[model samples]
Target: MKLDFDGIRLQAPFYDETHREWRDSVVRPFIDKEIVPHIEKWEKDGDIPLEVYQRAGEVGLFQTGYSEAYGGVTDGVDIFHALITGEELARPGAGGVAAALTVHSIALPPVINFGSEEMKKKVAPGVIKGTHHISLAITEPSGGSDVGNLKTTAKKDGDHFIINGSKTFITGGLKANWFTTAIRTGGEGIGGISLILIPADAKGVSRSSVGPKQGWICSDTATIYFENVRVPADQIIGKENEGFKIIVNNFNNERIGMAAGAVAYSRVCFEEAASWAKVRKTFGQPLSKHQVIRHKFAEMLRKINSTQAYMDICGWHIKNGTPNAADIAMLKVQATKTMEFCAREAMQIMGGISYVRECKTERIYREVRVMAIGGGSEEIMRDLACRQMEL
Candidate 1:
C-alpha cells in the first residue's frame, strides 16, 4: 500500500547511515513543511521567494557538499547526499524549486575549486548560510550546449577585468546575489574562455525576467547583460584560459543531478497514474480493468525502473570518483526520456484533470521539456556518450 519507491536501487556504495538519517531528518521534513504547501502558489507567481532558501539553510538543507569550516556539514562531492536531496526534492511538484534552491551546487563549486582562501572564507560561508544566492552562468546568447562558442568577453586592464555580452535561460538569474560567469579572455574557441565572479550589485550588470515559461516557474529564469562591468582580478575562478575544462566538469555533475531529479519525477508520475487507474472508471469499471491501460502503466513503470538502475550505477561510479563519461551521459538521455514518458502516460490516465492546473501532471508535463533541454540537450548527450564510448 505504500507508494514511495521501495524498489529504487540507489546505486549508493557511498551513502552510509549518517546520510540516510540526514535524508529522513532534514530533507523530508523540509519538503513536507515548506515546499508542498506553497509549490502551487510558486508556480502561479512564477518564482519562489528568497525566504525559501533561508529556511532551507536554517534547517541545514543548504549545507551539504560544503565544508565544516564554512558552516557546511559535508565536503567535496558527496554524491550520495546530493542524490538523496534530489530524490526528496522530486516531491515538490516543481523542478524549478529544486533547481533554484540548488543552483549553488553548480555556482559555488568553481569558486571552491579555484578561488583564494580569503575569497572562500568570505563567499562560501555566507552563501551556505542562505543569505546569498549564486548562479553558474556559462550559456551565452549564441551558445546553449556549446560552451566553447560562448561570445561574452572579459578583457583585463589595470587591476580589473571589464566583462561584456549577455546570457539567457539562466536559472535563478533574477535572484542571484553573485554569478560565476563565463567570459572570453583569449581568442576563439575553448581556450579563450574564463570564469569570473560577477556580483549582481555591480555597475553595468542588469537582468530581466524571462518566461511565462513552459515549466519551472518556481525558478526565476532570466537573461543577464553585462556592458563592460568591471570586476577585480581576484574574482576570476582558476586561470583565465583554464575555464573550459571547469565548465565541462561542472556540466557533467549538473547533468547527473538532472538525471537524478528526472528519475524521481518519473516515479512521481507513475505513482500518480497507478493510483488514478484504480479509481477512475470507464465502462463501469476502473481504468485498470482494461488490459491496454494496464499494459501502458506497466510500460511506464518499466522505464522508470530501468533508468533508476542505470542512474544508480552512474552514481556509484561518481561517488567513488571513477566516473565513466559515457555511462553518465547515457543516464542523462535515458532519465529525461523516462520523465517524458511517465508524464505523458500519467496525463493519459488522469484524463481532463491532468490537462488543468488542478493536477500536478500538467506542471510536470511542461517541465519534462526542460529536463531534455537543460544541463545539456538530449542530442548533445547522445553524441558525447557515443564519442566517449567510441561507438
Candidate 2:
C-alpha cells in the first residue's frame, strides 16, 4: 500500500506528463470520493446505482477515447491513457460495475468503424453523454465460446430484417438503450455473420436477469430474447457477412483488458497478504519474519511482476497497431496463470482470514475462474497461439 506503482514503470515515450497527472488528479479523486465507499454495497446489492453512469459521463470517464462531436474528448485517442484508466478502474472495487460502465467500449467500435455517419450521430452522442446505455450481444446460452456456431438469424424482408435467437450473459442487457448484435445473415460458417445496431425497445425483444454468478456481482447479466424483432436494414454495421472477423478482433482486445484486470486483482491479493503478514503473529514473530511466509510472498511477487511485463509489452504492440498475436495470446495465458497462483498464495498466507467473506482476497480468488473462462479459455488461448505459429 505504501509503495507507488514503482514496479510497473511507464518508461515508454508513449505516456507523458499529462497522462500521469490525469490519473492523479481526475481518476484518483473519483475513486476515493465516490467509488471506494459504496463499492461493497453495490457488490452486495448485485448492481451499482444507475446514476453512476451519468456521474461518470459528467466527469468524462466514459468518453475518453471517443470523438468531440459525440460529446467525448476531441483529441486523438491516447492508448496509454486508456491503459491507465483500465488499470485504475479495475482496481476500484467491483468488477461488475467496471464492466457495465465500460460495456460501451465493446458496443461502439463497429458502429464507428462501419455504421453510417447518421447512425453515429444518432447513438454515439447520447451514449457518450451517459444519457443512453448500449450492450453488445454475441454469446448465446446455447454456447458462448463457440461463436461460429451461433444460431441467431436475421432474415431480410425488404426494408427490415427480422431477427430471432437468444443471447445470454449479456452485460448491461437489462439497462441498455441499444445493443450491437451479431446475427446470422447468410448461409453458414463465419462468412455468414453480420453486425447490427438494435434498439433495446424494439418490439418482440425481451430481457430478464440471468440469475446469480459467482463473482462480478455488481454488474447486471441477462438473457436477451429476440423473437422476430424487426431491425431496419439501415442498422447493419459495415458490409454484410463480415461480422465474424470484427468479433474476433474485438475479442483479442477484450482478452487483453481481462488480462489487465487479472493482474490488478493479483496486486490486490499481494497488498492484502502483505498487510496481514505484517500484523499477524505466528509462533513468536510477525508472519513476514517467518522464512516460509516470506518465500510465498516472493513467489507471488515474481508471478505478478512477470505477468505485468508481458501484458505491458502486449499493450505497447497493440497501441502501435502491430501484429503481436503471439504476445496477446501469451499475455492472457501468463496473466491468468499469475492471477491463479497469486490468489492461491494469498489464501495460504492469510489462512482462515482469506476464507472469510469479508476479505477481498477471497472474493478475488473466486473471480479468477471466470476471467480464465470468459473472453476465451486458457486452453483455447494455447490452441490459438499454436495456430498463429502455424504449428
Candidate 3:
C-alpha cells in the first residue's frame, strides 16, 4: 500500500526509469496481492507457506538481479533493481516475512558465484522457481560473528565430506531444502574454512525451530544440527579453505540489502507515527499540534533521509564495481540505528497502540533488534568498517 507520508520521497540517484517501472508494475502489485494481506497471519503462525515463495518467484521477485540462464532477466538487472525490490518489500513492515522469502538471495549466490555448472544447473532453477528453499548457514551455537572461530568441522571421505556441527539463528532453516554451509576442513583459523552445499534432508541432518525471539517472528529461525552429515564433494563451493573469501564477498551485498530494508522499515514507522499524530488527541488537541510531537517526526525523517542517501551511495559503488566493503558495513550500521530510532519514536508517538500487535509500528518495533544484529551486528559492522579502512 501507500506507506509513505504525503508521497514524499528524497531522490534516489541509484534508481532509474526501469527501476520505477519495476516498482510500480512488479514489486508493488506482488506485495499488495501476495504479502500485505497475509503478513499478520504469517506472523501469528510463525511461518509462511512454501507456496508464497513459489508465487514470489513466479512474479520474478526472486529473479530480478540474477542471470537469465537461471530464470532471471539477463540484461539491465543490477544492484538498483534488487534495491527497489528490497525497499518495496520492506515498505509492508514485516521483516520476518521478508527474511523468509529472500533467504535464497544469500543462499544462492555462493552457488551462482562459485559452484560448478552442474551445481548451478541443479540448484538455481529450483530456487528461482521457489520449489526449493535454501539458506546460508554460517553462525554457530558457540559463536555468531566470529567466522574463524566457528567449530563446525567437515572431514573428507571417498567422494564426500562428513559434516559435524550445528548452525544457530539460521533463517529459513526449518524449511530450507538446501544450505550453503560454512565448515572447517583444515586447522583452526580463517584459512581453514570452507563452503559446502548440503542437502537439508541428508542423513544425520536435523533441525528444530529456535522458537520465538524479540523479532522476525514469522521467519523460521532454527538451529540446524549436522551429525556426520555427508555432502557430495562436488557440492563444495569455490576452492577448499578459500570459502571464507566467498562468504566475505557475499557480505557487502547482504549488508547493503539489509540496510535498505532497515531504511524502508524506518519510513514505515515514521509514516505510521505521523498519520497517528494527525488523529491522536492529547489534552483535547491533535498530537501533531504539539511542537514536541512535530519534532519527533522531523528527527525521524532526518535520519531516514540521510540513511537512504548513504544506502544509495553504497548501491552506486556496487553497481560501478568498486564496492567498498567497510562502507557498506557502516551504512548498515547507520540504517539500523535509524530504524531503531524511528521505531522508538513512532512507538512513543503512537503511545499504547504502538505496543500492541495490531499495528505495523508495533511489529516493526519488535523487529528492530534483528535488523541491527542479523547480517552483521552493529558492533561488528563498526569494527569491520574501521579495519577495512585500515584504521
Instruction: Choose the strongest candidate by lDDT.
Output: 3
TM-score for each predicted model, relative to the true structure: 0.95, 0.95, 0.97
Which residue pairs does candidate 2 place in steric collision?
none
Q: Candidate 3 lDDT, tens digit per residue, 65-106?
A: 777898867598889888877888888898988898889889
What's the CA error at residue 226 for candidate 2, in Å? Answer: 0.4
lDDT of each: 0.84, 0.82, 0.89
A best-first ranking of the candidates according to their TM-score comes to 3, 1, 2
Candidate 2 achieves a global lDDT of 0.82
lDDT of 2 by residue, 211-271 (tens): 9999889889889999999988999998899998888787767778777778877877888
Instruction: Tell me the RMSD of model 3 versus the true structure.
Output: 1.6
TM-score of model 2 relative to the true fold? 0.95
* Stretches of model 2 off by over 4 angstroms after superposition: 1-14, 74-76
Residue-level lDDT for 292 in candidate 3: 95
Q: Is candidate 2 or candidate 3 better by TM-score?
A: 3
Decreasing lDDT order of the candidates: 3, 1, 2
Model 3, C-alpha of 53: deviation from truth (Å):
1.0
Q: What is the lDDT of residue 15 in candidate 2?
A: 68
